[model samples]
Target: MIPLDEARARILAGLAPTGPETVPLAAGWNRVLARPIAARLTQPPADVSAMDGYALRAADAVEGATLRLAGASPAGKPYAGTLGAGEAVRIFTGGFVPAGADSILLQEDATAAEGHVRVNETVMLGRHIRRRGLDFAEGAELLGAGRRLTARDIGLAAAGNHPWLTVHRRPRIGILATGDEIALPGEKLPEGGIVSSNAHALAALVASCGGEASILPIAPDDPAEIAALASSGGFDLLVTTGGASVGEHDLVQKALGRDGFVLDFWQIAMRPGKPLIWGKLGAVPVLGLPGNPVSALVCAVVFLLPALAKLQGLADTATPTLRALAGVDLPANDKRADHLRATLTPGEGGVWIATPAARQDSSMLAVLAGADALVLRAPFAPKLAKGEPVEVIALAALGV
Candidate 1:
């Protein structure tokens, strides 16, 4: 079996980002940018007031001084006439500073009477004024390519005068769950059969990572059935759960071979997910995962999430992890890397304590669902006692 990192690298190397499409700014949230967004016009346009105050010449405004009230400058409407000496303009927040005004006397610090205003405090030059282009300059890059648009990013793009944005098309994923003993939820099951959960779980994962997922009909143990469904192209990537291992019913590789499927590598040095498969069928990349629920989801987190990120034109494709302390004594690991489902608790000094579930059997979907994190145990890692530091992937943070 190959190492997990090598398998992930090979899968990513075989895939490219989806093509770009234009969408309205309102629809840009969570979409990866295909091009940089530049500022269309200078922000503020000109020197403006940052507070509700009176715009006046700093030299003429002094403590206990009175000035003639010229005109009011509201947000959208500007005072056309310039301010003369001993004259002040009534300006509100976001109002352009009238010509010949160098400072602002806050309304709270001034008293207004008939046709005049009294300054109780001395006004400083250039105070309470926001200069032109304070937020951004025209043609300045506000956001770069490969960035996923957040609510803040959407606001920034709108403020930059962009009504539409160019983003990579959402990667379309075809999910296939194949097994003779598994039936759909709420269906009459054969004796000792189980309900299929991998397809729905994987589809949710794909959507969470910005990919569109279509769950294909389940295929039984027959190679012909598997091949027929897999070759129905139009997917950026085809994900198959089950039939990846070397068992008699594991016919994914064999079935695809009839349709010119090119095998890249199969199996990885990882616990609960050693029977992973990475290959290609014609133009669509194929990733075959173990049928076990825990194995399917864990491998999806390890490999499929990064693959989706790459396909969406994201700049960073690596899985994010956090540091935590072991809550129990861990035994020595062997050749396979381990991903122990664990619960996270707050420890002293702001450190997190990760305690693995007692039953790590891959069939226990409940244990995997209740887990807060997956503590990573590298191959050949030495035994670690309680309180030892380790790296972990926080499942909730990844929206798994």
Candidate 2:
């Protein structure tokens, strides 16, 4: 058995970043950038007015100065001629500043007749004017690579005059659930049959991390059948729920071994999920998760999701852990690292207290759903009193 960090490193070491593709600006949201995006054109190509007011020479905009309204400049239309001494132009918001106009005497600070205007207040030079390239200059790097474009990023890219962008393709994942006794949800259950939900849960987790997930049909206990189905999925990554352990009915290893695959690691020393398997079959990476619902989701959050992020060119894949106070006196852990389901609430002095669930059965989905975080207990950790500091991983990151 290997440690959690070793398992994570092994998984990442065997994977490669996905290829890049060109997409339209409308489809670039939430996609990772393949290369740095540079501005195609300077913002505010020319000097423009920011407010609806009179545009005139700053030297002639002093108090009590009267000027003739030579012409008008509305948005998208510019005055054909330049300004002269004691001359002003009726410029609206976003209108291009007429040539030779040094500043704008605000409408609120001036009194205007039919063709003449009188300045009531002193005006400063270059006031209320948005200069050329005020926001971004041409050829400037607007956004760097490896950034996941958000709605705001899309708008910013559009402002840079980009109609399309280059981004990494979303990873495609194929999920398989193996067992004859398991049936999908909303189906009639046979005697002693159970509902199959691990595939659905795994799909949701994969999709939330920006991967394309497809749940395949269930496979029985036959090794040949499992191998055939697993080998033909054609996905970037293959994930199986059961038959990963060495039990009699464990056929996932038999079908995925020998001919065209290289096994990276098989198991790890951890609670809830220990019978995990990872390797490469041809060019596709295979991740074998446990059948237990909570264990499957836990392992997905810790391992599988990180792999997806790495493939997507994400900078960091570390799971977030927070410090909290224990609500009860917990005993020492064994050789296997433990992840206990618990609820976190505010305690005295603004510290959060975590209370572990009484029953941590891997099959209990209700308890897992109610849990806010998984308090991490290192292997062979000593006993702890109530109010002791403990590390916790939030379950909300799993999108449960």
Candidate 3:
């Protein structure tokens, strides 16, 4: 049996990132940028007004000075004529300053009469004026490569005049749940039938990692049937839940072996997910998860998410973890590394307390559902006292 870190490293190293493709700006959110995007044109193309005021020469813009209003200049329409001596043009916000205009006399500080406006406030040169290329200039870098585009990033790209973006393709994953006694949700269950709940969790996890899931039909215990479904289905990676043990009903390994699948390693030193299996079907990575719902999802969080991050070209693929205060007295652990189900609450002095759940049965989905974090326990770890600092991986961080 391999260690968990070795197993995770093997899976991540065996895979390669997907290629890039051109997608419209509307579809670019959360996608990794494959190339740098430069500004298409200078913002504010020319000297424009930032406020509704009068455009005039800086020398003539003074306190108590009255100037004749030449014309009006609204947004998208510039004054055709230039500013002459003692002349002023009524310019609104975003309107061009027109030639020979160097200052803006705010309308709030001025009074308008029959044919001229009076300046009362002290007029400063270049006041209320937005200079050309103030926001960004042409050919300037708006965004760099390998950046994950958020909603704000998408808006910035649009401002740079890019209607389309070159981004990394989303990784494709196929999930297969196996068991003759398993039935789909909303279906009539037999005497011993169990609902296929692992697929939905896997699909959600895949989506959270930016990968699209192809949920295949559930395969029964028949070796031939499972083997046939394990064949290529145009997926970059294949996931299987249940039937990975040495029991007679366990046939996931036997089926994949017939298709030249190379088993990398199995049975990590973990409590719930010890029966896990990992290997490759040609170039596509195959992960065989335990039948227990909690075990399958836990393994997916530990292994599957990192694979998806690497596939998306993320520079840092490590899961986020933090140290917090323990709320209970945890005993010494055995050889197998344990990820104890726990809850986090606020303590005094801005301290976060992690309280381990009393019952951590692998088959209990309710316990896993109620947990907000996993208290990591390494092999041969010593007992922990209440209020002691311990490392915890946030459940919300893994999109649970």
Top-lDDT structure, candidate number: 1
The 10 consecutive residues of candidate 1 with the worst lDDT sum are 184-193
The C-alpha TM-scores of every prediction are 0.99, 0.90, 0.90
Go through the candidates in order and give the clash count of each. 0, 0, 0
For all the candidates, what are their Cα RMSDs to the real structure?
A: 0.9, 2.7, 2.5
Per-residue error at 100 for model 2, in Å?
Answer: 2.1
Pairs of residues at least 3 apart in sequence or in different chains that clash in candidate 1: none
Error of 3 at 379 (Å): 3.7
Candidate 3 lDDT by residue in tens digits, 188-250: 876789898999889999998789998888899898889888784788889999998889999
Measure candidate 1: CA RMSD: 0.9
Model 1 lDDT on a 0 to 1 scale: 0.96
Clashing pairs in 3: none
lDDT of each: 0.96, 0.89, 0.89
- Runs with alpha carbons beyond 4 Å of true place in candidate 2: 321-332, 344-356, 380-391, 397-400
